[model samples]
Target: MLPINRAVSRGLFAGLALKAGSSTDVAWARACYAIRFQSTSTHLTDASNRIRRRRKKPAFLDRTPFPPSPEEAVNNILYNTPNATPAPVTRHVLNCLVSNEPGVLSHVSGILAGRGFNIESLVVAKTEVPDLSRMTIVLNGQNVVIEQAKKQLEDMVPVWAVLDYTHGRIVERELLLAKVSTVPHEHLSEFVEHEIEGQEVEEPESRTSFSPLLGTALQRQAITELARLFGARVVDVSLDGVILELSAKPDRVDAFLKLLKPYGIVEAARSGAMAMPRSPVDGVFEDEASLEVEDDSGKVDATMLPPG
Candidate 1:
């Protein structure tokens, strides 16, 4: 079959479209024309021939070889914490830009699954345009495995870019939504008054006494007030409790939960860290600190992270 270049293929299709009203019809005529007229086999065959005839991979002066895998020294032990033994494995986050098409995620995940790397957390969402998406993937692995994974990801067609934000100084944040309890509108003021600590009270009046249901209401009221102080927004309310949502640094939010321990916590959910590099100003870094494992060699050691 003869090969059809872009100009010839488009010209041929244009002629077929003009004859759509004919008895043969567009679909049938188009299929016949495609089978008989438009061909790319010869062009592909020539390209394959050129590739086979090439002697060796081209070399450029600036080409840098991929880093070789390193072997551990006899006393290469590092500590994750001051007293902790046997440092934990490192985790890396890859931000992937991909075409918004079906099976793209499956293909990306399949590669990770095959490599035996554990995915700590993954968030996939569409971008400003419907035809593109960003996949933020967190995975645990050795340095060698991490580099190899990046190389493989770059080779896939659907993947447009894979930027690693693991070792860099990055800004990361997470979201938390909690279902907390609160008192009904009626007993709010009394519930609020009793929560104040060291309030010496004499024998109470009849109205001061709280019933069984009111006791639960008091507990819920304390919880709600605490949530409010943490800048949490009330999302939903019911006869029992309210659903509150908040966004904060992960560690600070963890501390907030510890403060809520006095009140009964019903439910909570958290998202994995969403991270990006801090903006640079005049070629200087605005954010300076980075989390690192302290090592004698002053190299990148696995800084153990608390499990999600």
Candidate 2:
């Protein structure tokens, strides 16, 4: 068996305690668990201080809580709440093609971080050609906010293409590293609430595009009509505030954005795009598709097993 991290082992034991059996040594087990928990914290802190001491610089150490195993997490939910079902979290992956240039990564990260979205994982590698890099960013946000982020990215000068990879067709992979911070229970509720609300607001976001009008008189009239008509908040203003962004249905967004094209506009940004499959083949069709793994038989066959 692989060595279990302290957090995982401790969490498992904590879960097991809630399912105590009469034959078990409850008092002794509880006492042992408490001691182990304190010792682990102390060791971790001491190790951190030692490293800082050697370096002679103050450094903040980040510690990550171990993710619960799927079974353990399910057990925790069922045991803690006998009546409620734990809803599965929806996750999405996005593939981005961008000009391989300086500041592109920073530009992308800025857009996501500014919107309070958490990027779960990211992988960047050069594609088959020079000066082109492919990026895979895994993120968790409400469907709305993520879509908005994607649209905003597409509008960015450096981005060539952005594809959502959650659906089946493309090969998708990401690398993740995390640091944990403990927040008080009261603060946690507020933080989580803010996250939820932000997601809800971003979901219905849509954009409109318009063609430039033939004459200046008609273009000015169109802009005025749109500004007077739309009730959604203005997220962006382009073409000297003639082109506007308003949260609305897909049709409304299209009508509003399209009305601006006749005003001698060179470019416009409609930042409400979300990643979904152009077709159903974007994700796995059945269980068989997921069970397939890499062709690793040759690699494994060449290695000798250690003596038991």
Residue range with the least summed lDDT across 10 consecutive positions in model 1: 287-296
lDDT of 1: 0.72
lDDT of each: 0.72, 0.59
If scored against the real structure, what TM-score would every candidate get?
0.52, 0.30
After TM-score superposition, the amount by which residue 174's alpha carbon in candidate 2 deviates from its true location, in angstroms, is: 5.6
lDDT per residue for candidate 1 within 73-147, as digits (tens), equals 323443223664644579887889999999999999999998998887787889998899999888888878878
Cα error, residue 260 of model 1, in Å, equals 4.3
C-alpha lDDT of residue 48 in model 1: 91
**Which segments of candidate 2 are over 4 A away from where they belong?**
1-89, 173-308
